[model samples]
Target chain A: EAEVAQSPRYKITEKSQAVAFWCDPISGHATLYWYRQILGQGPELLVQFQDESVVDDSQLPKDRFSAERLKGVDSTLKIQPAELGDSAMYLCASSLDVGGMDEQYFGPGTRLTVT
Target chain B: AQSVSQHNHHVILSEAASLELGCNYSYGGTVNLFWYVQYPGQHLQLLLKYFSGDPLVKGIKGFEAEFIKSKFSFNLRKPSVQWSDTAEYFCAVSPTYNTDKLIFGTGTRLQVFP
Candidate 1:
């Protein structure tokens, strides 16, 4: 089975520091998503991408967060000057296309701990 | 804006017991509903989804859900559960045939005892 790959399964950073997480989606998937999962809460959408082009980012905190998928394959999400409340599990998911009932496959996620 | 709500925050059950988790969504238009499970140290995996034509949808591991449009509810159920079924379950909703953004419920943590 093709699985989504994520790097740095765990990260610990001081407040105001910068952190970056990487994700490589399943092969041939065209749509990718980034989500933030707070403790005891469900995942919230942060950004959506369609083959390297951003489809939606309304919920993304643009002031301190940014994501890119230059090649439409792997993606990177960065948080600059992280705050204590920014500690959460950052998850990445992908689907075959933007339509139909195709289910999104999620990565293991990078757990961030901001001090 | 769409939102999903799950009533139970935590549930405990013994092996061979029946299970049901409540999920409701607030969306006026057509929507797609889904249930996802996250095992310990694992990523979120789809349990099932409801699109169209069927009010009841069956998923992996003997899980099923009923989509009640009038009530805006999609409740998950299983006749018998095992210890391995212990995990965090989430309900999510997205506008029908629209974008890929999904709104998820808080989540229900199920602890099944052996």
Candidate 2:
């Protein structure tokens, strides 16, 4: 099974510091998604990418968070000046394409803790 | 805005007990429904999905769900559950059959005991 790969599975940083998470989806997937899951809430979409182009980022907090897939494969999500409220599990998901009919596969996720 | 509702916040079940989790989405047009599970410290995984055809769809681990168009709901069910089945369940929906975004519900936490 070609599962999604993610690095820095666990991270702990002080408030006002910078943190980054990386994700490499299954081979041949075209659509990628980044989501944030609060302690008690379900995952919420933060950004979506079709290849290297961002298709939707309506929910992304661009002021402090940024994401990019430079080569249309592996992706990076960064949060500069992280805040205490930003502590959560950052999940990366991907599908064959932007079509919603296809199933989305999720990575193990990066758990971030801001103190 | 499109939203998903999961009425059951938490459910506790013993071994061999039946299971049912409710999921409702507010979308009048065509929609795709799905159930995802998250075990403790595990990755979120697909349980089942409904795009079209038969309303009742079966998934891995003896789980099944029924998509009721009239009720705008998809409820997951299992004849019996095991202690290993304890996890959080989330219901998601896409406004259209093939859209770019997937909206998820708050989620329901299930705790199973032997």
Which candidate number maximizes TM-score?
A: 1
Itemize residue pairs with steric clashes in candidate 2: none
lDDT per residue (tens digit) for residues B3-56 in model 2: 999999999999999999999899778888889999998889999988889999
Isolated chain B TM-score per model: 0.97, 0.96
**Candidate 1 lDDT by residue in tens digits, A1-115:** 8999999999999999999999999999999999999998999999999999999899999999999999999999999989999999999999999873578999999999999
lDDT by residue for model 2 over A1-115, one digit each (tens)?
A: 8899998999999999999999999999999999999988889999999999999999999999999999999999999989999999999999998777678999999999999
Score candidate 2 by DockQ. Answer: 0.78
Error of 1 at A78 (Å): 0.5
Stretches of candidate 1 off by over 4 Å are: B97-99
* Candidate 2 positional error at B106, Å: 1.4
Worst 10 residues of 1 chain B by lDDT: B94-103
Candidate 2: misplaced stretches above 4 Å?
A: none
Write down the TM-score of every candidate.
Answer: 0.98, 0.96
